[model samples]
Target: MLTFFSLVAATLCVSASDSTVELTTFNAGVLAGVPLWRERMPFLLSELPNSTADVLCLQEFWLETDQLAVVNATSDAFPYHVRLETHPSATPPCDATPLQAGLVCVQTRCPSNDSVDQILCALLEENCRSELRAMGQRCLNCLVLGSPNTGLLNDPLSCAVDTGVSYSTTNGLLLLSKIPLSNTVADGYNIATGEIDIYARGYLSAEVENLGTVVCTHLPTPNADRLDAPYFGPVEFNSIEEQQNAYIQQLMNRYSSKSPLFLMGDFNHGPAIGDTVAAEFPQVYQNVLDQGFVSPAETRVGLCTSCLDNSLKSTGSANVFIDHVYVQSQHASNVVDAKRLYEAVLPIGVPLSDHYGISVTYGIPVAEDPIEEWKTAFTAWKDAFREWQKNEEEC
Candidate 1:
C-alpha cells in the first residue's frame, strides 16, 4: 500500500566512470481479453513510468492488445518495446503429436488472493471454502491455457488451448525502453520446427545503444515440461534444464563478442547465484552463473518475489524468488538501488499483479571518453590552425 504510491521515477548518478540504467521487471498477470485488467492495469502502467526506469520487462502480458495497451499508456516515456510476435507458433496437427495427459489448466477463481492471491484470505478461512476440495488453483490458468474443446471428434490433442490461439506465444513477454533499442531480436524455443506450447514462451533482446544487451524472458515452469515434452522430440527432464538455458547460452555467446548483457523477467525458478545452490534447477542456475552472471536479489537474503502474499499466485504456490535480474558483462557493475514495486495489497485496491515487481538500477560502463577526449581534440585543432597561419605568412 505505501510502496504502491511511493513509486517515484528517478535515477541516481553515482559517478562519471560508469554509466547507469534502471530497469523493472513485473509479471502484469494480465490476459489479453480479461476484465480484471481494467481494475489493475491502468494503475500499474500509470505508476510504472513514474519509477523512471530506463527499461520495463513484463511477462504474462498475452495478446496483441495487451502490448498495445502498454504502448499506449507509456509510449510518451517508453517508446521502444519488443515481444515474440509469432508464437505459441503454429499449432502442430493434433494427429501428429502424442497425447499429453494433464489438464491444460485446472479451473479455479482468478480474482487474485485477497489473502493468498488478489485477496482470497477470507476464501482460505476454512469456513468460507466452497470449491476448495474439488478445485484449488488459479482460474486464470485454465482460461489462458485451454478453451472450448473445438477439435475433431476423438481428437484430444485438438482440444489443446495452445493450438487454438497460438499465432503468438501465450508466454506474454514484452520489453519497453526509454533508451533507443537496436539489433533487436525475438525468438521462440521450438526445440524443433513445428512444435508449440499452449503457453508459448521465449526471450526478447535489444541493444541499449551498445552499453549492453538486455534480454526479457518468461522461462517455462518445471511442470510445463509435461505439456511441452510431447510437442518437442526427446527433451531433457524439464525445459529449464535444456531448451531455455541453452537458448540463454546461445545469446550470451553471441552477445559477449559485441557487448555485455542483462537478463530480467520471470525465470519461474529461483536463480542460482549463491553458495547454497537452488534445489530447483540447481545446475541450470549454476551453469548460467558460471557463464559470469550475477543476480542483485541474491545478496539480499529473505527476499521473496513471488510469495503467498502476492495476489496472483497459483494455488499450492510455494514462496520463492522465481523472477530475477541477472547481469553478465565486464561493463555491468553493482546494484545502485533495488526496490520491490506493489509489494503490499490495499484494503480497497485490487493487487496490481500476482507477481510483485522488482526495480533495480545497475551500472554499465560506457565506451565514450570523458572531458579529456574533447579537450584533446580542441587542442589538436588549435595547433593545426596556428601551423596554417605560419604557412600562409611564408607564402
Candidate 2:
C-alpha cells in the first residue's frame, strides 16, 4: 500500500526537459468550384514536401485525392500523418433538387418496367442512387447533385448504384509530422452537433514519443447549435460545444502531466479580447478559452488568419483570427515561438491558401510516460486504489 501511494505521488510529479517542436496549422481553402481552388490547390500540393515546418495541422483539404496527394508528396520528408476526417456539417445537394420544390429526386427506386408516373416519382433515392452511380459520369453526375443534367437517367430503366463516398465533401482536416507519431486515432463527439452525429466534426490526435499528444480539429460555425439541448438562456456553449470543451479537458487531464498537450485548428471563432468580431460574438471562442490551454499570448493577438487582405481570401470571408495553436499552461515551457504563415503570395505566384497559417515552435519535455493502453490500465488501478482507501477510512 505504501509502494502504491509512492507510485501515485511520483505520477503527480513531472519533470520538464528541453526539446523544441515547430508546428504549423493552416486552413487550405480548397473547396471545389470555389474561387481559385484549382490554381491554389495544385500549387499547394506541389510544394507541400518543401515545407520546413515540423508538424502540420491543416483544415479544408476537402477531397480524398487532395489528402492522398499531400500524404504521397511528403512521404519521405514528413513521414507520419493523420487524416482528421471530420464529417461535413452540411450534406451535399444529393437530398433535393431545384426542379422539385419539396421532394428529393422524385421519390423511390422503382423497377425498370415501372410506369412513367412511377418512374417520375422515383427520385434517385437509396436504391436508385446506387444504380445511378454505376452508370458512368453522365449518370453519376445525376446521382451526385440530384440533377439529371442530361435528363437521360430520369427514367427508371436507366437507374444505377455504388457505395463509394469520394464524390462528396468530408470535414477536410489533416495532420502531418516530421517527428515519429504513434497511436494515431480519430475520435468524434458523443453529443451530436446540430443534432446529428453524421456531421462528423470531431478530432484526431496522436502521441509524439517523449513530447505529448497533438490534436487537430475544425469546430463548426456558431449558428449551427446542437439541436438536442434545452435552451437555458444565452449560455456560453450549446450542449455540443460544452461537450467539445469537455473532451479537450479530458485530454489535458490525461496528458499535461506527461507533456505539453497541443490543441490546434480552425476554431471558427476568434479571440474574445483582441479580435473585434470575436469580442462581439464571444461564446464560441470563449468556450474553448475556458478549457485552459495555453494561449498564444498577447503578442500574436489580433492576427487575422482569414482576413480580406489576402488576395486568395474569398469574398465575404470574415476577417477573424480563428485558426489557433495552444498548449496546456503546465507545459507552457514548450512554446519557443508563435507566428503566422503565408500572408502573401508564395514563389509559385499564388497564395498557399485562402486563410493564413499559424506557426508555433515549442519545446517538449522528454520525460516519457507509459503509452496510452498501459497508461489507461495504470490510471484505472490508481483510481480504484484511491477509492478503496476512501471506503476503508469511512468504515
Candidate 3:
C-alpha cells in the first residue's frame, strides 16, 4: 500500500514538472453539527478525486473522530499533506474547541511510514476528544446564561432552555492539499467592521512553494447578529466587511511582490452575483478584483444559485454563488477552466450542506505567450479540465 509520506513525495515530483496547478474549493457542509446529512459526505468526497486538485479548500467542516474517518476513506485517492484551522477562543472551553463551528481540513498525499488509517485516527482522536470535551463543558456553562446560580448544579436539566438544549456548535471551514503547507495562520474576520478579530472568525494561510501562497478562510455568518443585534440584534455587517477587506489587504502587502496568491472560502454573503443581502457586500469583492484577482467559478458559471431544497418553494430563487476561488491576474496565463461543481445537486445521498462546491483549473505553458496570454491560458485550461474529467471517470 502507498504510505501517506510517499504520496507527498509524488506530489512534489509532479509539481516540479508542471508549471501551473489547479485549486478547488468546497463547502463540505457542517458535517458533525447536523446529523441528518452525515451519510452523504462520502459521495461528496468521491466526487472530487485528488487528481483534480493540487490544493482543496473546504468550508464548514466539523472535525471529529467519525467525520475524520470518513474524510480519510473518501480522500484516499489524493494522498497528500493536510492542515486545519486552530480554535479562536483563548479560554479553556472555547480555546479547547476547534476553530469556527467550521473547521478547515487540508490534505496532500506524501510518503511516510504512517498508514492513512493510522495518521487519520491519531489526528481525529486528538482533535475530536479535545473539541467534544470542551463542547460538553460549554454546554454545561451555557446552562447558566440567565440563571442566578453560580455553582455547578446537580441537575443537568435545571437550566435547560425551552428546547431543553444547552450547547450548540457548528462546522467552520477546511483546506486540503497535495503539497506541504508552510506559514499556516488562523484568524477571524468580522465582516461588519472588516477587522481581523482573533475572537470570532478564523483564517489559515500557508506557502505552497511553486503555487505561491494560498489562504483559506471561514468568516462569521449573519446568524451571530440574531443573538447580539439590537433591533435584529448586532448587525455584524460592518465588522464582517472590514475583516474581509483587511484579509485581502494583508495578503497583498505580504506577498503582492513575491508570487501569485489564491484566496478561497465561504464568504457567507453573495455579492453582485445574486440578489441577496450578501450581494450588498461590494467592498469585499471589489477588494479582491482590485488586487488583480479573478474568480474563475463566477466568470464561467454566472450567478450560480445551486443551493436548493425541495421542501421549500423558493428553491431556485435561493440560488447564489457564495463560495469562491480567487487567483492572481499575473497567473491568468495558467488557468485552464473554472466552474462550480455540485451546483444544484444535493450533497451525496441527502441535502447536507446549504452551499455547493466551486473549482478552477490552470495549465502553465512550456513557454510564455508573446501576446494575448489569457487566450493561451484559456486553451490550456480547457485541455486540463478535459483531462481531469477523464481521470475522474477512470477513478
Put down candidate 2 lDDT per residue, 119-158, tens digits, no spaces.
Answer: 2223212334333222332222333222112122243222
| Model 3 CA lDDT for position 16 | 21
Please identify model 2 stretches exceeding 4 Å from their true place.
1-17, 84-169, 190-199, 222-259, 272-281, 315-318, 346-350, 365-395
Backbone clash tally (model 1): 23
TM-scores, all models, native as reference: 0.64, 0.61, 0.56
- The number of the candidate with the highest TM-score is 1
Candidate no. 2 TM-score? 0.61
Compared with the true structure, what per-residue lDDT tens digits does model 3 show for residues 165-229?
A: 22232234456677777776554433333422212355567777556788887654433222122
| Alpha-carbon runs more than 4 Å astray in model 1 | 1-18, 32-38, 86-170, 191-194, 224-243, 253-258, 271-279, 329-334, 346-349, 365-395
RMSD to the true structure for each prediction, in A, is 13.3, 14.6, 18.0
- As a whole number from 0 to 100, the lDDT of residue 112 in candidate 1 is 36
Comparing 1 with 2 on lDDT, the higher-scoring candidate is 2
Ranking 1 against 2 by TM-score, winner: 1
Best of the candidates, lDDT? 2
